[model samples]
Target: MKPVISRSFLDRLFAAQDYDGLVQLSSFFQGTSTCRLEKADYGLPRPFFLIVESLVWFAQADRSGVWTYFEATSAPRQQAMLEALTAGAPAGFAQAYAKGVSGWRDEAGMAGLDRWLSARDDENNRWLWQLARANRAQIDELLS
Candidate 1:
């Protein structure tokens, strides 16, 4: 069974900007295993985006850590998780997984995000992309 992650832990890590802790937590998502989220304890009622944003921040903080985690996970498993997370996500959360995994540009997985975005024409998707673009500098600064 996969390890269960409490929303309180996520809240503490994110609030403290604990990139190392976030990377360590992501290791639980490796391989074909799924990590369970304790949704009720989350800072926000809907915690999916909160988790995704933290993952994205961690990926930005340490590209090698993100690459290592992805390398250990199968493509199909990764794709399934991506689809599930983005399916009915709110505006900025639409491309969360894509933005997180796209850090590994040398891999074919990056192309999937481009394709996914290309196929979408919704306002939320557009706003998500724009928000990502606008926050690029801030994201980089956080990493620095």
Candidate 2:
């Protein structure tokens, strides 16, 4: 049987900017669906439906915390995390991407992530933007 929220639902979930609605939808998904949550599935149960749903929700609810997680994490690995977050990949898939990008690390790459976060205009993505704009020192302090 198809999951309560299918690939199309996941697609819309990724594009959703309304943080409140996304939260409700995610809750509905969790309650009504048989799917299991996995970071590798982008917080979804299925790979193709990876939507970064959890991270987006978490980012919306707590920007500083997300940034702290990013700052405390390695740059290259974090780049992959940022990519997965942006690309709307399955939850834990980012770790694999981080492993792939382990060879390259630079301030420019880090800055690019900032720009990417800043450029996101979606309502759901705004929290990510907020987290991105937060000062690194502040993030470190808040997270620490």
Candidate 3:
């Protein structure tokens, strides 16, 4: 199956990290079904599912949106995690799986995501964290 979204698209979206852009992009993803479909794809890391999930949350409110943008843009570790996941996963399962299996270092990615989202000082970061949490929960459910 074709991947629903592009890594560059996500990278740009994350890089933009603006409330207006996030809402626009989130709406686009919601309309296109990119985030939901991508989450369902078995080949990608569950953490990414969380990233997008939090995006939806971030898109919901004007103030929260600002926080969302601030957190994503300011947090280098989170960005690095996203970058690593992006490099490994890119835009498709075919690529993501190949890189994932060849020692793609998913644990660090997950840990980074977990730390960023779970931190209490980051009310701004919670939306993304929730998304990540949801993704992990889904994967855990599947594994269990």
Candidate 4:
């Protein structure tokens, strides 16, 4: 299936290293559905989908708190969020997320996660963009 967002648009955002834009596009593509998405739904590569979805969830967590993130997030999304954070976010940010998840249903761990995310807000975005740039070959189809 083809993407609703258009490859040219994606290519432009990618070339500009617009991580936030890419993340927003993913949210746009998700529409009103709260369900976890499969790559087949959007036709984006797995890595692209992973990073974008992760950022969306991370941003929500950053703004609302980790407790909220856990409450709304599905099981598959939870795993993908961890994968994206570990793969591209700063070590401490990923560690904080993991630690926070240890007691996700309780406020104890979520408080520290909220603090940690608030302290270093937006820094992880660059790392995710850098990861995409590093994997240019994998996303070359966007360029084509």
Judged by TM-score, which candidate is best? 4
Per-prediction TM-score to the true structure, in the order listed: 0.30, 0.36, 0.25, 0.67
- The residue-by-residue lDDT of candidate 2 on 1-144, one tens digit each, is 332444454445445646554454445444433434433343333211222343442453245323444444455434435554556543443543343244224434444433443344253345442332333233222222
In candidate 2, list every pair of residues with a backbone clash: 17-124, 39-91, 39-92, 40-92, 41-90, 41-91, 42-90, 42-91
* Clashes per model (N, Cα, C within 3 A): 0, 8, 3, 0
Stretches of candidate 4 exceeding 4 Å from the true structure: 4-11, 24-46, 87-89, 140-144
Model 3 CA lDDT for position 86 = 55
lDDT at 96, model 1: 47
Q: What is candidate 2's TM-score against the reference?
A: 0.36
Q: Candidate 1 lDDT, tens digit per residue, 67-140? A: 45455545654555465456655544436456645565455555544344334324433433333334434332
Better of 2 and 4 by TM-score: 4
TM-score-best of 3 and 4: 4
The candidates, ranked best first by lDDT, are: 4, 1, 2, 3
lDDT of 4 by residue, 53-111 (tens): 55755688777777887777666556656665676566676677677556688876677
Best by lDDT: 4
> What does the lDDT read for residue 77 in candidate 1?
44
Lowest-scoring 10 consecutive residues by lDDT in candidate 4? 32-41
Worst 10 residues of 1 by lDDT: 39-48
